[model samples]
Target: MTPSQRTLLWVYAAIIAMWPIRHLAIWFIFRKLDILTPDSPRLTMDHPPLVTAIIPAKDEEGTLAECLASVCAQAYPNLEIIVVDDRSTDRTGQIAREFATADPRIEVLTIEHLPPGWTGKTHAAQQAADRARGDWFWFLDADTRHSPENLEIVMEYARDRGAALTSLLPEMRCETFWENVVQPLAGIVLMQSYPLFRVNNDRSSLAFANGQYILIKRSAYEAAGGHHAVRDRFVEDIRLAARVKALGLPIRVAIAREIGSTRMYASLDQLVRGWSRILYDALGRNPWRLLGRLLDPLIFSQTGHVAFVVALFLLARGHTSPFAFWLLGLSVVHHIFTYTVLARVYHMSVPRSRYVAWFPVANLVMDVILIRAIKMCLTGRVTWRGTAYGPTVTSSTRPVTKPVSPN
Candidate 1:
């Protein structure tokens, strides 16, 4: 090999060396949160707060009914369900209105138009909050389903921790081939990057929240200006969490594998489009940083597999010594260990978890998707909820000039 090639190989080797350190950091951090426990309680049930569950949906007819049904079945008694349908062309608005008419606690609101510099969904959520009568607000997506005890558990968790804002990272339901193979891997990558335990406690600027299931106190929501404050953010959940953190409000997040679940994207096209919508926002408009952040897991998995194959080839050719064989075994063992732990912590099944065994192959396939996402973000071509959004969403990120008061 030439000198340049040798240097590249060394660079690859260094990347491999760092993988275990990153994995260990994630494992140790999540281990504190007790993520493996299916029913770990973060709070007591006796003092659960009155909560309003709000869903801002657009054309979610297929999932809206089941989602509302789940909210109505909450174990917590002091609850209200408010569904804001944002100009849905489907029966989403009709279904929500029917449910509202049937139940005194449920109310349906039909939003007219999305104003400029406002995220379509957040505009609806802000309107829902205006009509909410509860002391706490829970924002959930239409695709999300909850277990009966979610509200009771989450409310108690907020009270015990004195958290103004709390969100649950639910176990994603993966049924389709793309959903099963690729979707769970996204969860794995997220867990690895931001350890849940550290994120909950450490008072760092690095804040993240899953929009699927968020529970926030009304006072805190108003204090931080609620969804109005982040009206235009594509990733409003995380932006609101960041604002809460910036204002020094207490924040808490819990693993909610048993409390709730969601099927975010059904097909490969959906996955790519959905992920692209916020990938740029998630990257904070930095292409190089985004590339670096995405490259780690891909390179790490590929290197381990390549190392094992080469070592095996050498051994079969009688060119490998005991140390070479040991190296190959150690690499494979470490990959298995990390992947297994990641899958288990993220609530994937045993067989599906074994898909990590094909990390090398999977990484190769995902790189194409990541590249496409980056291109979409860079080109300012993102579409969500039947509307196209431009790059960066600068206008939405601007704080509202007028303060909003609770109703």
Candidate 2:
């Protein structure tokens, strides 16, 4: 091998060294996180603060009923449910109304028109908050199904931590084969992208929140300008968390399997589109960062698989590098450790955790999501739940300003 090629091999080997460190460190940090479970000590209050569960759903007829039912069944004494049907061209409104009729605590709001500058969800949430009579607002997605004790447990956690904003990273309920193989891996990537270690730290400026299950103090939410502050953000959850953090209030996220569960995407098509949108926003719509994310699998965690194969080929051609073998060894051990951790902490079923062995295929899926996200960013528009949004707030370079109203 040429001297230049030998030096390049060393550079590559150094990069490979990072794979195990990054994965294992993240796992350890995850292990240290205090997760809220059914058995966790519940917070008792002389008078519990009212919690308003606001669900913003568009064409979510299939899932809205279950979500509303879960909210209605909350163990917390003072709780109310508000369902927002955001221009759904389906039975979403009807289902919500049925639930409202059955339960006095439940209310439905039908949004017939979306203002020009606001995204459908933020607008719906903003309107709901305006009429809500609660000290706290729980913004939940239609896909989420909570345990009876879920709200109580989260309220306990939030109170104990003194957090102004608390979001749970739910136990993902993955049923399909593809979902099982890809979902956990997607979460791992997302965790890396968001870096919960700093997010949970009050001193750190970095912050993130899961929109699927978020609990925010009404005062804090309003003080940070509520969803209206992050009206145009595709990743409003994260932006809102930043807003709260900027106000010197702590925002925290925890792995709360017993608190609730959510099936984010029902099929492969939904998975692709949903994940692409999230990845696009996570990268901050920066083309360079998107490119780096696209190349992550090629050079980082999964690089060892392809590098090992090439190493074998080079050996057959009487060309060999010790670093290649070193990296191959590292990748193999890393996968084994990761799969073990998955079985131990992530997936309840050992067989399901074995899906981590399919990392190579999952990496391909990640690449595809990255590509789709890049395309969306370049087009300057993202279609989510049948709504297309462009730059629509002052946060971006081009601002689209309009009043928040119902027509």
Candidate 3:
């Protein structure tokens, strides 16, 4: 090969290699990210703040009991638990009522109908907040299971940082084969997409929070207009965080793997819809970004590298070119490094060979999630908890309603 031709080929290879390098950088960022562990923050509050744990449920019969039990197990004293049964057709309300009967700290609220222009969860959360008498509103999803120290450690972290809103990065609990593979890769995509560093930066406008576990001081929650301000938002947690941060309130996102764990979906069907809604709303319904995100699984993630290695392996087996063999070796090394880092990020340990063997199938599932999300975004509506909502919902300005007696 001529000198100029060789130089041109090298340039092309470098350009193609940038994608994998970018993925590595994202994983490294997560590896060094802050973790709020069990033994963190030695300082103790003289008088512990009253924290109200609010959970909004809509047909969450399967997980409601465990969720309530976890919150009730919190080591922190001066705690209140509110569970809103928002038009659940299942045994969700019955289970919640059972908990409320057994524990004086637990309160259950039932809503007969969802007021127009508010997402069901947001509306339910607002109801719980309205009746909460705690100094802080600790929003926990019904699907999440928390460790005893979950509340205490986060409380200290927020107090030390003087943060108004705190979003905990929970340990994602995966059970099924699809859950094991797709969830971790999805977490990697979300972390990179949101960039927790930017979200937590005081000056950065970027803000994000996981709905599964968000702790907000009552004053800050009120200042940011609470859920009422973001009632129409499908991705209310993120919207609430943005509002808080925009108001110059300090927000913190931490690694809380020891504190809490959440299993987001029960099946592949739920997984697709759940992630699709998040991606569509989180990306601000931008088609171009959605398209790129759809392709990320196949191009920029470890799955992309895994596929590349397989392709190059096949080529190198028969090709006489030394470049093919060298490229194959490099790609294999990159995949191994990324795979290990991703496992560490999730606090999960799995055999690399097993993961790689199923990587391609999982990658396709991820793509389907983004694709469905894009279509939903373009269509300007999506369904949640069996309710269909437009791209946006708007409500008349109103004060928090007084709590009604549980049915």
Candidate 4:
């Protein structure tokens, strides 16, 4: 082989060797990070504070009833549930109203219009918060189902930790073929980008929270400027958590698999649209960060696939080398090991994790969706729950809402 060709082969071998080391480091860090669970012994409180649970609905008729039922059955004594029907053309409003009629604690707020510069979900949350009488505010999605003890345990944890804002990552429920494969891949990427341990313990201004279930003290919510503070943000949950953390308040995030689960999307098309509205905007519209995120998984997780492709090309040209073969084998082993670890961490079954070999397909799908999301955002064509937003829209706009009686 020519000296230049030999140099290229060494470079490729070095790159492949780095991936396994990175994966090992990630595994070590992940094992050390605290994985909060709800199975711990419950704590008792002298005074059980009233918590206003807000549910924002927009074309969520399929899941709203179960969500309401779960929230209504919470073991907590002092709790009120508010369901915001965000101009749904479906039975979401009707279901919420029925729950309201049956349970006096459940109130339905029907949103007639989504004002400019406000995302529908944030607008609905703001409306509920305005009329909330609780000392703490709980923002939950219409798709999430909570255990009866969910509220009690989460509240107890918040009180014990003195946390101003507490967000629980719900157990993800995936039923479809796409959901099973893509969800785990997406989650690994997300966690790597926003490490939960760092987000929880780091005082360097980084913060994150899942909107499926987030609870914040009323004082901290107000001090952080509330939902109206992030009215236009597509990923309002993370932004709100950042705002609260910026005020020097303690914010905690935990895994709540035992307490709740969320079915984020029913089908592939819906999943694409839903995540497209989030991923790009979550990058803060920074091109460099977006590029880095797009390439991260390809380099670290898919090094085996990359190596194989390169090896195939070299083989066809009759330029194969032992270094290339060794790199290919190493990359494959590293990829499988990393994926298995990811599956175990994310609570996927062994059968489901056997599909790790197909990760290249999943990774490609994710890349396409992310690139499309970026395009949609840049073109001012981002739409969520029937509301379209412009590229220039920001979270600084205040939402207008009339107060309603919590009683």
Candidate 5:
């Protein structure tokens, strides 16, 4: 090869080498929080803040009633539940109205018209927050089923820590094929990218929150301009977290393994639709930047290399040597160490985590999905919550009606 070509090859090698090096730094430096069942703290408040539970539902009738029932059953002393029916063509509004009638603490609003630059969910949530009478606002998805003790536990944690914003990384219940394959990758990427240590210290640029369940102090939410500030953001949770940190608020996040759970997507199509909605914005549109994220699985998943070495030994036959065997042994050791560490930190069962052993193929599949997601995002053809969203999209400015009780 010519001198220039060789130099270019070396540059490419360095680029590839940089990814794993960065991941190694993250794994070593990121502090992990204790993940076992936590003990309840003694009450320190004379009167706990009134917690407002906000649900933004769009064609989510199936899960709306159960979600409402769970919130009503919370052990927290002071609570208000608000469900925003974001132009649902289904029975969402009717279900919410029925719940509100039986319990006056519940209020339902119907958003007949959506405004410009506002993502549907956030728009509905913003309206709900505007009408909320609670000291704290908890934004929850329609699909998540909460335990009765959910609010009490989270509120205590929030008060003790003086958190401006807090979110629970619910225990994921994966029953489908797509869920098993894709869900593990989410935790892997999260562990690899946003190490818990740096996030707690509030020093790094890596900011994140699962939007499924985020609780923010009312004052903090309003001060940060609330959901209005992130109306245009596809990945609103991270954007909101970044805004919270910018405001110098004390932000706390924890894994709610036993507190709550969700079945995110039941089918592969729904899974892709859910992820694709935010992929381009999540990684940004720059190809170079996206390539950086594409390499994370490799850093986290070394088991694929072991399989390669085994295949190489079989193919080499007579050509196999002591050095080859030594290399294979090292790869096995690396694979075992990485997966074991992951299992402990994330509170994952080792049996289920053995799935990490096939991460190479999974990584490749994730890359394709990401690429497709990015393409959809760039083309302005992203659809979410049964609504087609694009750069040219606009909402009707017509005023909406306040919901009336079913009775």
Candidate 6:
């Protein structure tokens, strides 16, 4: 081989070596991390502060009843639930009303019109917070199911940590084959971008949260401008967390695998659209950062697969060498080890991790979604909950009002 080609081969080998080392370090970090549960002694019922739970619903009739039921069953004593029915064509409003009628603490608000510049979910959350009368405001999605002690546990954790904001990364419940494969990949990407350890550290500016379960002090919420502060952003959860961190307030994030679970999407199509709406904005509005974020995964995590492909191509062309063979072996081993670590971190079963051979395919699917999302964001054609939003039309220039519904 030429000198240039030999140098390139050495670089490839170096890249392959780094993959396992990086993942091994990550696995060690994850093992040392703590996951929160409802049974912890730190969580107690003593003088529990009043909390208001806000849920935003739009065409969520199928999951509304169960979600509301879970919220109503919280072990915390002083709690109120508000369900915002944001122009649902389904029976979301009816299901909410049934809950309200049976429980005095539950109230239903119907929103008919989405104000200009505000995303539907943020708008609904803002309205519910305005009507809330509690020391803490809990924002939850309609699709999440909480354990009976979830609220009590999270509230106590926040108070003990002296945190102004707290959010939990719910255990992802995946039933379908695609869900199992793709969900783990998504989690890897998210964790890599925002390391949990750094996010939990008060000194670090990095902040992240799952919108499925977020609890913030009412004062902090208002001081940070609430959902209205991130009214135009697609990933409001992370943005709000950043806002809290920017103000030098303490924010805690932990794994809630046992405390609560959420099935983000029921099918593949829904999953694609849901993540597309998030990845584009979460990476940033800058084109260079978006491209870097998209390429980083392929280079860092999927290097083994890429090397394997290149080795096969060289062999097919009747060009073979010891370096190429060594690269292939190292790449395959690295890929297997990386996937094994990921399965353990995500709590996947043994048989599931054995499907590590499909890692390349999964990475390809994710890359496609990222590219499509970037294109949509650039074109201002991103759609969520049957509403199309543009980049330029995000400021709330008009006043928001609640719709009167005869229920």
Q: State TM-scores per candidate.
A: 0.83, 0.87, 0.87, 0.89, 0.83, 0.90
Q: Poorest 10 consecutive residues of model 6 by lDDT?
A: 348-357
What tens-digit string does per-residue lDDT give for candidate 1 at 306-369? 7778778878888656555665766676577557555564344223344555555556546765
The alpha-carbon deviation from the true structure for residue 92 of candidate 4, after best TM-score superposition, in angstroms, is: 0.2
- In candidate 3, what are the lDDT values of residues 40-88, reduced to their tens digit? 8633667888899999999999999999998988888789888888888
- When summed lDDT is taken over every stretch of 10 residues in candidate 5, the lowest stretch is 345-354
- CA deviation > 4 Å runs, candidate 2: 1-9, 311-352, 392-407
Which ranges in model 5 have alpha carbons more than 4 Å from their true place? 1-31, 34-38, 42-46, 202-206, 298-310, 313-318, 321-334, 341-354, 357-361, 397-399
What root-mean-square deviation over C-alphas does model 4 reach? 3.3
Ranking by lDDT: 6, 2, 3, 4, 1, 5
**Maximum-TM-score candidate:** 6
CA lDDT for candidate 6? 0.79
lDDT of 2 by residue, 1-407 (tens): 55775686677657656655665875677676867778987768879999999999899988888888888887889988788878889998888887777788887787777776777788888888887899999999999999998888888889988999999888787888778777876776566667777898999999899988889999999999999998877788998999999999998888775668888887888888989888788778877788887776677656666666776676677655665555456556645654555454336312235576676777788788888998988988888887777765332333222223221
How close is each model in CA RMSD to the real structure? 5.1, 4.7, 3.8, 3.3, 4.6, 3.0
TM accuracy, model 6:
0.90
Question: Residue 228: error of model 1 in Å?
Answer: 2.0
**236-286: candidate 5 lDDT, tens digit per residue:** 887887788788777777766566777677777776667655556665544
List the global CA lDDT of all models.
0.71, 0.78, 0.78, 0.77, 0.70, 0.79
For candidate 4, give the lDDT.
Answer: 0.77
Error of 5 at 28 (Å): 6.0
Which predicted model would earn the best lDDT? 6
Q: How close is candidate 1 to the true structure, as a TM-score?
A: 0.83
Candidate 4 ranges beyond 4 A from true positions = 32-38, 309-324, 344-354, 392-407
> Candidate 3: which stretches are off by over 4 Å?
1-12, 19-28, 301-334, 337-341, 344-357, 391-407
